[model samples]
Target: MLEKRFKLSANNTTVKTEILAGLTTFMTMAYIIALNPNILTNYGAGGAELWNGVFLATCLSSAVAMFVMAFLANKPFCLAPGMGLNSFMAIVIGQLVATTGMGYVQSFQSMLCIILIEGVVFLILSLLNVREKIVDAIPLGIRLGISPAIGLMLLNIGFGSNVYIADSNFNQFFVMKDFFGALTASHARDVMTDAYPVMVLSAITMFVGLFVIVVLASKGVKGAVIIGMLAASVLYWVCDAVFLGSNPFASLATASFVPAFGDMASTTLFKFNFAGLAQMGWFTAVTLVITFCIIDMFDTIGTLVGTASRAGMVDREGNMPNMKEALLSDSVGTIVGSCTGTSTVTTFIESASGVEAGGRTGLTALTCGIAFLLCIFLAPIAAIIPAAATSAALIYVGVLMMTGLKKVNFDDLSVCVPVTIMLIGMPISGSIGHGIGLAMISYTIIKVFTGKAKEVSGLTYVISVLFLIKFFLAV
Candidate 1:
């Protein structure tokens, strides 16, 4: 039955391979199960009940979305509440709370309404094939640049550090003058010596794990990254036990493996408040919706194209098979996620892990969906996997994604210039949309000024103008 449904054999993959690949993918991205709830809790302002609600919502929504992807798209992609989008939601919620003097629950309810509206908008776009048209309208140069740009962005995130000063409430990042000043500061040695050893150890562990994954991958080992992450996690556990004298499993003792049904029912399940939409004003609501739609659209597009390219799913023209179905799956995931009280659930680039692990059909996604369901009972175990371990997987995946850069045509200035800007802008701007927007605007300008405007499609021109407006309004 599985064979006929997923065409596993036709895809040159077996049930075993698909299951292993799914497990590998789940291990790589499972940190989100805990991390999402941690972020949404907002330093306990939401209270334990809300925290538990978001946690349950995260798991259920992710599982449902992954299952939808499996059956509807027959693709090996897993959907989850996205990292950047979640962070953006937190910030927006905070702003709303501060500006409107509303309680956390009300602010959260309002944000859910916004996400619900955004999901509906996306569903309409997907149904009308507008989303697919936008994808097709993107120039080949910009499309090729998206993967490498995201690669650099991931690399930047993996290596960046922040220092917390005693008096300051916020973390002080080492950027601009602070980064260069560290080179000659008289307090540099003191700062290094006084720095927490755990931070240093974490960084070292991440690099070592990343190195191990790279070596194993080079040797053609299946699930090499997952193995490396597990090994690195063991090392971290040992270090914590020896140096901190802490019981590594102490958290498990306090964690509730059983679902908190009362908490989930009380807080956020179908508790969305559309009344908050009127409070946000028409302009704010519209801008927020547009922002979410644009960001989520491109993020999904980039992940689908980048991972599909690596999986050999993209054709000579850079189009993936069943893209509309894949996109529909994404939109449906977002809608379900919002209704369940989480952020936008979209296709994860970490799906590339399963692709690299040899997943080729919907079976891999089904496996992942089942794994997510199991995780509802294993939250404690999932929580124990340190960020340092998953950082290694991200770094390794970023390295693999950089291979897309070689496909860009650098000989032509018009193509090269926009692509170069996108490649550099993504990491620096910390936004895929920003990178693609800059590239499109530049590409249109260069083509027009160089008397090659006819080469640019009408859709490209329309998109370029929209991007220009987005940037202008952003400023």
Candidate 2:
């Protein structure tokens, strides 16, 4: 039944392979389950009930989107309340509170209304094939650059932001950018205090896990990512127990296994405050909605194109099959997220981990969706996997994706400059959409001034102008 549904043989994959790939993808991106609620609830200022609500919403909405991607689009990508979008949603909530004199909970519900409108806009665009046209509008040069750009972004996450050590005051120290980049070990020690040694352990664990996966992959081993992650997780556990004098599984003793369905039901489920939304004024609401739409549309498009390219799912012209279905699934995710209470749900770049693990069909997505549903009851178990372990998978996947740069035509200044900008922009800006936006603007400017204005497509021109306005002119 599974094979017939997912066409496993047609995609040259087995049930085992797809399932393992799905697990790999889940392990890599599961941070969202805990982090989304924390960010959206403003570190509990919105109350514990709100936190629990967003937590279930994150799990439920992500599962819904992944299921849609599986059955409707047959894509391996997973969806979640996106990291950046959630942060922006939090900001918008804060602003709405300040400007409209609404309470935080009221403002949050109003923002959900905004998210619902944004999702409806995306659904309309996707069903009308406008989203597919936007994808098609990206130049071949810029399209080919997406994978390598996303690779750099992964490296940024893996090494720069993946693992952090907290001080006594709860200040974060990034292992790579803070510890190793410190003037000296003593300087790092002074800043991180008792947390410095944990940073060292993370560095060692990350490299060990990365090397393990690399060696296994070199030997053509299947499930190398999961194996490496398991090995690294065990190592982290031992180190924490023996050296840090802490029990890694101690949290499992007191962690709640309940789904918090009641919190979601009362706090966030179908809680759209249209009165508060109207109080925010139409201009503020419209501007925020447009911003959300532009950022989310391109972010999803970039992740799909980039990861699909890395997985060899794109054709010669850099277009993926089932593009419309995929975009529509993303819209569905956001709509469901608003109703359930979370940020915009979009495709995650971490899906590349699964693709690299040999996932080739909807079975992989189905498996991931099931895991997300399971997380509602087993969040604690997933949380103990150790951030260092997933860092290894991301770094390894990034290294592999960087190989796509060989296909770029560096001799062409137009392609080289835009691709180069995008490659750097993704990591620095921490936004796939912003990176692609810069690439488009650069590509369009180069072509227009070089007597090649006629070569640029009409939609590309319009998108370039839109991004330009988004970057500098939008209120």
Candidate 3:
């Protein structure tokens, strides 16, 4: 039954291979289980109750989304509350709390309302095939560039040096001179001396693991990324135990091994603030909803296409099988995630790990979903894996994603120019939307100047202008 349903043999894969691939993918991306709540809890100001609620929501929503992708889409993909989206939600909540004089809880609830609205909008778009049309509207040049641009973005994130300074008003890039100066003055000394031993050791650990993974993968070692991450985590734990005398299992003792079901079921479950939404003003609410929808839409499209390309799931014409089902699953995940008290959930690029590991069936997604469900009881253990370990996986994946650059056509300046701009802008701007917007605007301008404006689609022009208004005019 499983063979007929998933077509495992047709894809040249076995159930054992699919299970291994799924486990490998889960190990690489499991850090999100702890990291999501850490980001959403706003440094504990949301209190233990809210923190626990978000943590449970992250796990449950992710599991549900993966299952949907497995059964409906029959693809080895996973979904989670996206990293950039969650950070944006945090910034928006902070703004509302400060400007409207609303408490943190109220502001958070208002943010949830925006996410819910965005999710519903996504559902409508997906059902009507509007999202797929938008994807089709994007020029082949830009579509090809999107993957490499996302690769650069992931690389920047993995390095942990792309700094964005957040103030009371908004987040902005740190001054380049000041940022470089600080890197040289403090970071240089900290790496050489005992002043920040942990920082130095963390860097070393990450690089060593990355090197190991790269070498092993080159030799066709199966699960090399997961093995390297686990090894690096063990090294970090040993260092902490010896140097800092910290108890690795202290959190487990404090929180207990059982899932916090009672707290999760009561607090922040389906807690939308429609009245608070009205208080935020219709304009602000609408703007927030649009922003969420745009970011989530492009991010999902880029990731799905890029990862599918890597997995050999896309045909020569760039059409992916069961793409509508895959897209609908993403939409459903966002709606489920929002109602459960989190940010917009979308398809994760980390699913590429499973693809790399020879995952070719929905059974892989099912295995990953089961792993996320198990995390509800193993949260404490999951929390202990340091960022350094997973950073290696991200960097490795980024390296793999750069293969998309081979498909780009550099013979024409109009195509090459936008692709180049997008490739550089993504990492520097720290936004996939910003990079894509720049590419579109540049493409349109170049086409118009070169007497080929008709080459661009109508929807492309409309989206470019919209992005310009949003990013530059702050509308």
Clashing pairs in 1: none
Candidate achieving the largest TM-score: 2
Q: Which of candidates 1 and 2 reaches a greater TM-score?
A: 2
Q: Could you estimate the TM-score for every candidate? A: 0.91, 0.99, 0.90
Model 3 per-residue lDDT tens digits across residues 1-475: 8899899989998888888878867876787787787787796787777778888889888888888889988999888888888988989888888888888877887788888888889888888888888777778878877877777777777665422333333423222323334566475453334334555556766788789888888998877877788888888788878886776667777876677767666666788878778888998988888888888787788778778877788777676788788888777777787788788888887787778778888888889888988888887777777777777777888888888999999998998999999999988877676788788899999999999999888999988888888887675
lDDT of each: 0.80, 0.93, 0.79
Query: Which candidate leads the pack in lDDT?
Result: 2
Kindly report which residue stretches of model 3 are placed more than 4 angstroms away from their true locations once superposed. 161-195, 242-247
- When 1 and 2 are scored with lDDT, the better candidate is 2
Order of the predicted models by lDDT, top scorer first: 2, 1, 3
Segments of candidate 1 deviating more than 4 angstroms: 161-189, 192-195
Q: Give the TM-score of candidate 3.
A: 0.90
Q: Candidate 1 lDDT, tens digit per residue, 206-276? A: 87888988889899887787788888889889987898676878998888889886887887888887777
Residue 47, model 1: lDDT of 87
